[model samples]
Target: MRILVFGGNSLLARAFTASAPSGAEVRIAGHAEIDAPELLDGVDVVVNFARHPDDMRLPYDPARDVDRRLAKRVSPLTARYVMLSSRKAYAASAQWDATEDSALCGQDVYGANKVASEAAIRRLLPADRLTVLRIGNVIGPERIPGRRSFMGFMLNTLADTGEIVFDMSPFVSRDFVTVEHVAAQLGRIVELGLTGTYNLSSGTGIMCGELALAVIRGHGKGQLRIIDPRHADAFRLDVSRLVRETGLRQTADEIISYCYNLGRALG
Candidate 1:
């Protein structure tokens, strides 16, 4: 299978390129190549990992329409399109795991933008030729420090001061899938010719505290401290569809070990 990829420098793009299956042939497209329709010639699929800046404060900004424009450019091509969406597109739900059919009532600006972006792309490409993957928190060897990347921030703190601090209670949970696993799943989706929206995740929740502790264990000396004792909502994705279709899933222990291993690698 021949593939063309955008956002070639992103973590997902790098992971997919490095971990693609044996039969897959991947090509990273340059900025100029995106405008060239011939770039999609003989390409079986086009996976876009590019992100758009969405600011509700600036509602009329044209810069926020990057995805829509790319959809328009690639719509005429024969290759199927794969879009990487986020789990944040769903409204906060504590009663049940969010499914592909769940209401897209996410309240944040980023979520709202994703909802709009998905709709816009769907309008351009027919359902049979489009695949949207709503992914969860992805973990890898990110070492940057800041709120922009949570794992990176935690690791940086541990490296600098041997401490990992949390503003919310450590028990707060979120679904996390390793970068390598995400890449492998994408290969599965492409190879199987799966279409429509699917939740790509670990199918379980890992507590923030547990992950921090694992990281500390990997770092060999860091400690976890929680500044707030208030409860925070835990969110997980229902991966029944993905598993039934691809025979792929992740256990909680595997998720914990992925974090632990990341800590060891980055420490």
Candidate 2:
């Protein structure tokens, strides 16, 4: 199979390329390089991992509308198109485990962009030709310190001062999936031609305090300071569709352990 991946420099894109099938021909391209539509010729699948939610300077509507148009252009060129979305696209509610059918009432600009992008893809491509993966918190080794992600912040702070600080309560829980697991499942989804939306997550939640402790233990020494003790709501994704379709299992302990070790190694 011939596969083209946009966002060659992204963590998730790198992992996916590494985990792709041995015999598959994969080409990596950055956003600038992908401006040439000829690159998609004879490509069996196109996977887009390029949207940036961390850029505060970029306005929401412009970014989202651009992505929508890009999706429309790419949908007709390939046999299969996969878009990486975020779990943040779901509506804020007391619900713990959200499924694919949940309301997409994202209020944040980043989340709203994802919703708009998903809607655009669905509108442009046939159901069978498009696959949307609503991913959760992806944990992996990152080279740069003080990046925008939670793991990035924790790792950078720990490495710099041998301490980690949390302004919020540690009891807050969130779903986290390893980059390796995400890569493996993405390969399966592409190879098997699975379409529609699926939640890619650990299918379980982990407390912030527990995750911090694990990181400290993995690093062999670090202090965790919590400014506020008030607990926050726990949120997890219902990944039944992923398991039923791909037979992939995610364990929280293992994922967290891998991330902690990766952070320590990077540090």
TM-score (all chains, Cα) for each model = 0.92, 0.92
Q: lDDT of each prediction vs. the true structure?
A: 0.80, 0.80
Best by lDDT: 1
For each candidate, how many residue pairs have backbone atoms clashing (under 3 Å)? 0, 0
* lDDT minimum window of 10 residues, candidate 2: 55-64
- Colliding residue pairs in candidate 1: none
> What are the runs in model 1 whose C-alpha is more than 4 Å off?
30-33, 54-63, 94-96, 145-147
Tens digits of per-residue lDDT, candidate 1, 144-255, equal 6563576878888888888998888888888888888899899889889999999999978888899889988887787898888877656788888888888988888997
User: What lDDT tens digits, residue by residue, belong to model 2 across residues 188-235?
Assistant: 998888999999988889888788888887887889998877765457
Scored against the true structure, residue 196 in model 2 reaches a CA lDDT of 90
